[model samples]
Target: MDNVISVRDLRVLDGKKTLVGPVTFELAPGTTTGLCGPSGAGKSTVLRALVDLLPHGLTRDGHLEVQGRPIRYGKGDSGLRSKVVLVPQTPVVFGGSILDNAVFGLRHLVRASREDLRGRVEQALKEAGLWKEVHNRLDTPAQSLSAGQRQRLCLARALALEPAALLLDEPTSALDERSRDTVEESVAALRGSRTVLLVSHDPAQVERLCCRTVRLEHPETMALTSTAA
Candidate 1:
């Protein structure tokens, strides 16, 4: 099978300075691959670069391909992003009920009837492992959910788009142990079905969740190592 996403000599630059990478990797279809490294190794930045969400004034250089199409640099291509969604390190919840949050991204990207949209949201919630808890209370304020649920809700929102790949940036970084476990289980369930690129600073977490890993080193070294987990 073809790779879902591919990066070759990808690097992020701040003015003339290289802030990240000279890293490369391929995300195989239906597999969970970890992008793991120490703090300041630019794991999260790599995720942003893939989706064309790099911060202002920063630019990415090198080849990026989604499915098999080459992505042009310096373009904020909405279509590219829609196919490869990024769920940030911090889960962001907007003002609304649980149902509203789940359908946030889909409402804009998809032109479908209310029933169809609801059906997709329902399926995404189940994929995120949040349906059982929120199905009956979808109308309730999303803020009522705990920290981990909020994160999974963000995941559900992204999943509703039916993106070709998911870029998760330190998904469990902000949760308590129990909440972290819950999120891990949700991610574990995605393996072999959903293409995932998980950015994690926690080696143990990567070990438990990823089939293989791409390790990023500091900019000074400009080296990346790939190994099976």
Candidate 2:
């Protein structure tokens, strides 16, 4: 399989402090790789760097390539983000119907007729394992769904974009046990068809859902300098 994302010597800095990295890994197409580490190990920070979504005052240095093409940072690369989408930990629901939230990102990212848009949303919802639960209530308010459902809705929104790779940040961390299982099934179903980089602190979850795992550790000492290699 081809690598959808490659990172070498990736590091995140907050002002003069080294908060994360000098980490390296590759995400192959149609595979799920877990980014596992303890809190403050910069797993989430690494995900942010992939999409150039690093928090304010934080800067990153590394060689980041997506789909074998070098990503030019500081270019406001929304297009790159569309291709390798990031679904963050918290499930965010906008003020709208379930259908509206599902197609929220798709409508702006792709141009299509209303029927076509609905079809895409339906497909994404099914892929997210939410169709059977929400299909009859697409027109209902999005806020009415449970937390796990909301997260899957977010997943569906990202899936609708048809991204080459998905950066799932602790997808089940915020969910209850039952909800976690449901979400896990959704992620497991994508094993051979989607390229995924899943960041989690749960080793069992990683072992169950990921084909391979990349372990990250907290830096023992801050490095003042970094190399792209």
Candidate 3:
């Protein structure tokens, strides 16, 4: 497997609490892996550790390399927010218009021009399955959108980066069934090129999407399951 990411003995600790592993896994390009566990089992924390975003007063340990090199702090090697995007649980819309929120991250691309950015953000919106509903109202506040719309906007924001991988933490927890399907369809489309790591409690969704499954039980039990019938 052409591994896009490799983690060895990954550990994350927040204050005095051990949030994630002593865990290890590799994410190969063209594969989707699901991180399955009950709430507070540190599923989200594991994703955060991958991105070096373990919240307030948290620290990470162990070897984590992206693309092929060690991610050194500061100098862009460790900027997981850019290379490894995360879509948190619930709808997290930025304080801006729909277009603004969607295009927010694309502005950091020095090689991309303004027109290119606008065009690409719109394209991402369309690809996220949320274009027509908000295209005419691109200037409207992002928070004004429905829960589903907001979630789609977040997906668009993550896609704006053209990230090497995406980490989702309970992405469908707050959506209606229809909205959930929309997001799942978008995720479905991302397979086989866009590497994805998702944390979900829904067994049906897990069975449907993941190429592999890793179950983290409490702080000590870890099982990696293959997608075999």
Candidate 4:
């Protein structure tokens, strides 16, 4: 199969100042790839650039493609984001039941019947390693879930879309050690079935979860390096 995502000479800029990249990499189908570097190395920034979610006033430049079609800087709209779903470092749960949170994107992006959407949500929750814990209480308030559960819930939400690739930005940074382990298990389960680009400051975590890694140099150096795990 072809690469799920391809990026080359990508850069994020604020006016004339270069904030991130000139980085390049590819995510093959069903592989877990890590993006890792020290703080301020623009690891998170690169993920944002990939999904065209850079903060206001910042812009991206370079070659990006999903399934081989080029994505222009400003052309990465809802359609692009749907294919390459981004799960931010912080988990965001809307006001509703757990099932509601999981099916949020599907309700907007897919024109499926309620039963079909429910089935997809169930599958997503399972893939995220969250179904066993919450399947019985899907109608309960989502805010009641613990931090790690909330994070997995967010992952389930992204998974429900059946995205071409998933961009995870420091998904475990905010969780406690135990929670981190749980989330890692969930990520590990995705290895051979999902295309994931994980951003992490913890090298050990990257080593544990990713098959290979892309290392970003300090902002001053502006270099992107890669190695197989």
Q: Over the full model, what C-alpha lDDT does candidate 1 score relative to the true structure?
A: 0.90
lDDT of 3 by residue, 1-229 (tens): 5588888877777666677777888899978899988777788889887887667788877887888777753244535678889888976777878888898877765368779888888878887888988889999898898888888898888888888889988888888899888889888888886889999999889989898998887666788888842
- Per-residue CA lDDT of model 4 for 1-229, tens digit only, reads 8899999888889998888877888999998999987788898889988888889999988899999888888854669988999999999999999999999999999999999999999999999999999989999999999999999999999999999999999999999999999999999999899999999988889888888888888544543345554
Model 3's alpha-carbon lDDT is 0.82
lDDT of 1 at 223: 42
Q: How accurate locally, in lDDT, is each candidate?
A: 0.90, 0.87, 0.82, 0.91
lDDT, candidate 2, 9-97, per-residue tens? 88888877778878878887898888877788888988999888888899988788888888876666768978999999999899989
Residue pairs with backbone atoms closer than 3 Å in model 3 (clashes): none
* Model 1 segments more than 4 A misplaced: 220-229
lDDT score, candidate 4, position 139? 96
How do the candidates rank by TM-score, highest first?
A: 1, 4, 2, 3
Candidate 1, residue 115: CA error in Å?
A: 0.5
**Deviation in angstroms for 150 in model 3?**
0.8
Q: Residue 16 lDDT in model 3?
A: 63
Tell me how far the alpha carbon of residue 220 in candidate 3 is from the true structure, in angstroms, after superposition.
3.2
| True-structure RMSD for candidate 2 | 4.7
Model 4 scores a TM of 0.95
Pairs of residues clashing in candidate 2: none
